[model samples]
Target: MLPLSYAIRNLLRSKSRLAQTVGGSALVVLLVMAAVAINQGMSRVLSASGSPNNVILLGTGSEESVQRSEVSENTTGIASASIPGIQEILGVRAVSGEIHFMNYISSDDGSRAQALIRGVSPAILHVHPEVRLTQGRFPAAGEVMVGRLAWRNLGLKQDRLKIGTSITLNDQTLRVVGRFAAPGTVMESEIWAAIGDIRVVAQRETISCVVIRLEDPEDFSEVDLFAKQRLDLELSALRESDYYGRLSEFFSPLRAMIWITVSLIALGAVFGGIHTLYAAFASRVREMGTLQAIGFGRTTLLLSLLQESTLACLTGTLLASTLAMLLLDGLTVPFSIGTFSIEINSTVALIGILSGLLLGIIGVIPPAIRCLKPALPTALRS
Candidate 1:
């Protein structure tokens, strides 16, 4: 077998070509990572936002979005009293009367951006155990608890959403008295305010929806029965998980487009890498023949050449992975409903590395074969 040093020396032989190969490989690897992050991040956000045992009651026509839903203030009482399997937390019914509002909010720095604000009673926390207040307390009237990514989705910096920072909601100025984290979920891109305060400020007299947690997820039929039986209320019931699943389906096309775009560009890079490898190996035919004559054989030389390509690809992937960790991990991307942090976790990194290694092997094959196609005499003479 050819010494591994020979492959390393060949890569070091042409600095310019090596740089081109490595740079191209890095860009392709980065594109693949970005695609994975976007797909997985969106998937995670949707999945984290829902629990199967939870049920949402909204206006009949507004089942698709809570923002458009308007349910009766009495709906919570009706469901909590009538639903047989409702979960009770500390003797309090796990029912949240929430008002969802979206409007342009101005940060303390006077920067304005669109924001999703949730008006909720204290029971919201009881309903959603995932929300943990990292700083300050839950919001009161004239105050708001910013979700960790709320400011980012609003295009404001982290400092603008911190405790004591104030933001304008229409003509009203609401202080950010707290910060909460609901990791991997859309709730992390919302501002929580007291239900009464938002109703007064947003000029809405009706609650948006009533969220109910069930002791048995399968007991959804009871909630459905309530919504069905109450014709005057004009209500509909949806499982929280199914709602987010539909949301995920809605974003599928967008994610597909990202993958398609990345794939096309990566294909171009693959072909370009092939051309580069062909040129690099073609120039080393005489060197390869010398190795073959020394009992290394064509297979040994081919493996050595493959090792060079894989080394360059692996190095480029490492660089791309580093860049992704620094710039993309924890980066918040705002979507239709809210924002989700791009989690560059192990699964994503592993997929990216495997993609790069596969690209290296696949891209090297034709070029490697082409370089060895000629007779030993012909190759050595070239």
Candidate 2:
């Protein structure tokens, strides 16, 4: 068998080719990590946002999107009175009727930006325990509480939405009272205001959805039955978690697009590496012939080729892991309704390393097989 040191020494023979393969491998791994990070980030946010014990009441035929759903002002009272397994907080049923609006908000500097606004009552805090104010007080009528990442969602600077800033909504000036955060959830990118205020400013007479927390998760059947009996309101019951999960599925095409685009670029890089490996192996045919003459098996040469290619790929993996950790780890990106942190954790790193090794094997095997298929005398003479 050829010594592993032979494979290592052969790589140093052409520093330029070594550098090219290493650099190209690193770029391909980096693209893969970026794509994985995006999909993982979106999934994390959606998964963290829901509780199985919670059920949403939306208008029938609008289960796909809450923004398009409309529940009547009397829906909340009817649900609280009719539902049997609703969670109660200090004698108050954990039922919240909210008005969800997406509209252009005029900032302090007179610039308009689109934002997701949720109009809620004081019971919101009781219903959604994940949301907590980090600064100042909760928003009241004529006031709005901006999410911590709302500025990014609005494409504006943080100072523009900070506490004490004034925003205009339909000619009405609303003051920023606080900033809240719901970590690992899309709630961190919304603005909360009083329901009456939203109704007055947005000029909408309808409630978007009713969010209800059940005492027992298994009580979803009761909620479903209630929705079915209420044919008058034309309402449907959906689990809160399932709603966000569906939203995640709706964005799946984006993840697919990312993979397709990055895979093509990585494929090009793999082809480039294959070319480099072919030339490097072709240049060493005389050496291979001499090794064969000295009683080394052809399999030894093939294994040595694998060893050399893997080392180059592993070097690139090291570089890519470092860059991903420094840049993508914990990096926050805004989405349609909220923001999520790109998580480059241990699993993602492991996947990236394995992908790099796979690329190396795929790029090297065909060229190695081709180079070793010649007659011994022909290889020696060439």
Candidate 3:
């Protein structure tokens, strides 16, 4: 059997081939890691955004999107009074009627971008306890509060949305009064304002939905029953967690598209890596024949070849992991609904390492088998 040093020395024999193998593997693994991060980030944010104890009252037939749903402005008052078992803080019910508006807003420099804006009263804080004010205070009339990561969605610099900066919505200028954080939730990318301000700017008489936090998750049955019995309100009740779960399912096609695109690109890279490995191994055919003549079995020779390839691929994996940690991890990505941060957590890192190992093993089989196929005597002559 060949020593481990022999495989290591052979890898360094041709600098260009080594570089090609490592670089190709790195690119492929990096792509896989990125795709995993995106899908996971999107899923994590959506799942974390909703709480099981909360329920959303959406207009009938508009359950898919809150931005499109329209409920009566008085629904908040009616639901708070009618719904039993709702969470109460200091004798105040946890019911928030919010207006979700998506529209173009202009920055101070006249840069325009579409943003997800939510109009809410102070009751929102009770319904969404995950939100915490990191700076200044909650938005007041004629003012707005930006989420800590909202700048990413707005396509502006962080300082541009900082306190004291102003943004224009529907030609109305609103000052940024505060910054808030809702870790791991899509709300982190939204802009919040006073409910009346949004109503005036959006020119909507109806609110988007009514969000209610219940004392117990089991209380959802009562909420559902209420929605069913209240035929005048034209309302449908859905658990907050179920709503976001549906959103995740809605984005399944997008995630599939990402995977499909990565697979096609990786297929090309794999074929190219195969050609490189074949060429690198083919050049050593006579060497392999000489080793076989010296009592080394075909299995040992194949293992040595695999060892060399796997080493190169593992090295590429390390490179990809480093790059992902530095560039992709914790980066916020904005989509139509909201923004989610890419997190290269343990699971994602493990997936990348496994991908590299698979590339190393599967990529070398055909090339190794072909290179070892020649008869001993004829191969020695070459």
Expressed as tens digits, the lDDT of each residue in 1-382 for candidate 1 is: 7678977888899999889878888889989998999899899899889989899998999988888998888887887888888889989989999999998888887888889999988899877888899999988889999898887788788898889888989888898888999887899999999998899987887899999998899999999999999999899999999899989998999999998999999999999999988888888778777766676778877898899899888888998999999999988899867898788999889988998898889889999998877888888788
Q: Write down the TM-score for model 1.
A: 0.92
Candidate 3 clashing pairs, residues 3+ apart or interchain: none
TM per prediction: 0.92, 0.97, 0.97
Alpha-carbon lDDT of model 3: 0.93
Worst 10 residues of 1 by lDDT: 287-296
Better by lDDT, candidate 3 or 1: 3
lDDT of 2 by residue, 150-230 (tens): 998888888999999999887888999999988888989999999999988768788999999998999999999999999
- How does model 1 fare in lDDT? 0.88
Best by lDDT: 3
Whole-model Cα lDDT of every candidate shown, in order:
0.88, 0.90, 0.93
Candidate 3 stretches with Cα past 4 Å from truth are: none
